[model samples]
Target: MSERYEYQPHRLLRQRVRDIPSGAEGVLMAVITEDVSPNGIPHWVDLAYIRNKSGREFTTAVGNIEPA
Candidate 1:
C-alpha cells in the first residue's frame, strides 16, 4: 500500500533532479493532494512546491524531495 503524505510546511528538503546539483537545498512550501482516480478508490498523489535558496520555485512529485 502507498503511504499517506502529510502537509509539511517549513520542512527543509533537497530536490532530486538530474540537472540541479544534489547539494542544493530547498524548503517544502506546501503539500498538495491531487485526486487522479474518479471511478472507485481515490488515488491521491502528493506534490510538493519548493523554493530554493535563490528564490526559485518548482513543483515535483513528493518522492522527488527528501529530508535535508
Candidate 2:
C-alpha cells in the first residue's frame, strides 16, 4: 500500500552577530532569527532587520544580503 502525505511551505531566517574589539579573528556572539512560519506553512520573506556597529538599525524587504 502507498501512503499519502501533505506538502507544506516554509520560511527560514538565519542571523549571525559577533562582537569584535580592536582586533579579533572570530565572532563573539551569533543570533539566529526566529522562524516566522505560522501553522508550519510555507511562506516568503516580507521584511528583515539589521544593525551595524554604529548601533544603527534598519528594516527592508527581504532582498539585500551581504557580510558586514
Candidate 3:
C-alpha cells in the first residue's frame, strides 16, 4: 500500500527522475488526488506537496519525487 492523501511531514522526497534534479531532497507533506485532463480524458493524478531544503513548498506530479 502507498501513503494516502494526508500530511506526512516526515516523509522524504528525493529526485530520481529528470523532472527534478538528481540528489535533490524535500519533505513530502501530502498526496492529493485530483481529476485532471491531460489530453481530454479525466485522469486521477497524485500531486505531491513538498517542502524543499530551502523551505520553499511546491507541488508536483508524484513520479518526479520518490519516497526516501
In order of appearance, the predictions have TM-scores of 0.48, 0.30, 0.48
In model 2, the Cα lDDT at residue 22 comes to 20
Native-structure RMSD, model 3: 6.6
In model 2, which runs have C-alpha deviations exceeding 4 angstroms? 1-45
> Among all windows of ten consecutive residues in candidate 2, which has the lowest summed lDDT?
22-31
Candidate 3 stretches with Cα past 4 Å from truth are 1-23, 37-43
Count clashes in each candidate, considering only residues at least 3 apart in sequence or on different chains: 0, 3, 0
Ranking by lDDT: 1, 3, 2
RMSD of 1: 6.4
Against the true structure, candidate 3 reaches a TM-score of 0.48
Choose 1 or 2, whichever is better by TM-score.
Answer: 1
- Report how far off residue 2 is in candidate 3 (Å): 23
Clashing pairs in 2: 9-41, 9-42, 10-42
**CA error at residue 64 for candidate 1, angstroms:** 2.0
TM-score of 1: 0.48
Tens-digit lDDT track of model 3 for 1-68: 23323333324534322226454557776667766655855566678777776887777777777655
> How does residue 16 of candidate 2 score in lDDT?
37
The lDDT per prediction is 0.61, 0.35, 0.59
Error of 2 at 55 (Å): 1.0
